[model samples]
Target: MPRILAIDYGLKRTGIAVTDEMQIIASGLTTIPSETAITFLKDYFAKEKVERVLIGEPKQMDYTPSESAKLIEAFVEKFKNNFPDLPFERVDERFTSKMAFQTMIDSGLKKKQRQNKALIDEISATIMLQDYLSRKNF
Candidate 1:
């Protein structure tokens, strides 16, 4: 089976995650600059078989779209234009950053290591992917 890719899009950086070939485990892939995310995905898809791309949909406590949603929507539009054949889905991303931080702490990461924003972003993407996997059998 092909892998399912996930993205945690931010203003400056975008975190990436992917499922195993058997689609059992979700793992952090990398964090790339938002400016270069399209190029990065293009390169990645060229080498790997991704069945779908799951983008994080940030929401507020009231379940309304967060301020960051506009930027993410713009990026999604571009992504669709760039890869028309690729499928996309949205997964609710709430408290993913905090969850990532806790995950780092639980894993015994040092203070300095925990401060790495890129690592946090990657972990956030992984958490989002894991959450999605847990909710759906797919």
Candidate 2:
């Protein structure tokens, strides 16, 4: 089976994650500047057989769309335009960042290492992909 890719889209940086060919495990791929995300994805798609793409949908505590949703929506539009043949879905991303930070603390990452926002973004993407896999039983 082709691998599935997940994206944690942020204003400045975007995190990427991918599943194994069998779609069993999710692993962080990279973190890139948001401005170059599409270019990065285009290259990655050329190198891998990605079955589908998953993007985190930010939501507020009341289950309403968060302010970041606008930026995400804009990005989605660009993504669709670029990869019209590719399919993509949105997964709830509420608290994924917090979870990633807590995970870092639990894993005993040093303060300096944990301060890397790019690393946090990558971990957030990994967590989002894992959550999707868990829900789908894949």
| Model 1: per-residue Cα lDDT over 1-138, one tens digit each | 999999999999999999999888999999999999999999999999999999999999999999999999999999999999999999988999999999999999999999999999999999998888887784
- The lDDT for every candidate, in the order shown, is 0.95, 0.95
Clash list (residue pairs), candidate 2:
none
Residue 75 CA error for candidate 1 (Å)? Answer: 0.3
Candidate 2 residue spans exceeding 4 A from truth: none
* lDDT over C-alpha atoms for residue 85 of model 2: 98
lDDT of 2 by residue, 46-119 (tens): 99999899999999999899999999999999999999999999999998899999999999999999999999
Runs with alpha carbons beyond 4 Å of true place in candidate 1: none
Q: Model 1 shows how many backbone clashes?
A: 0
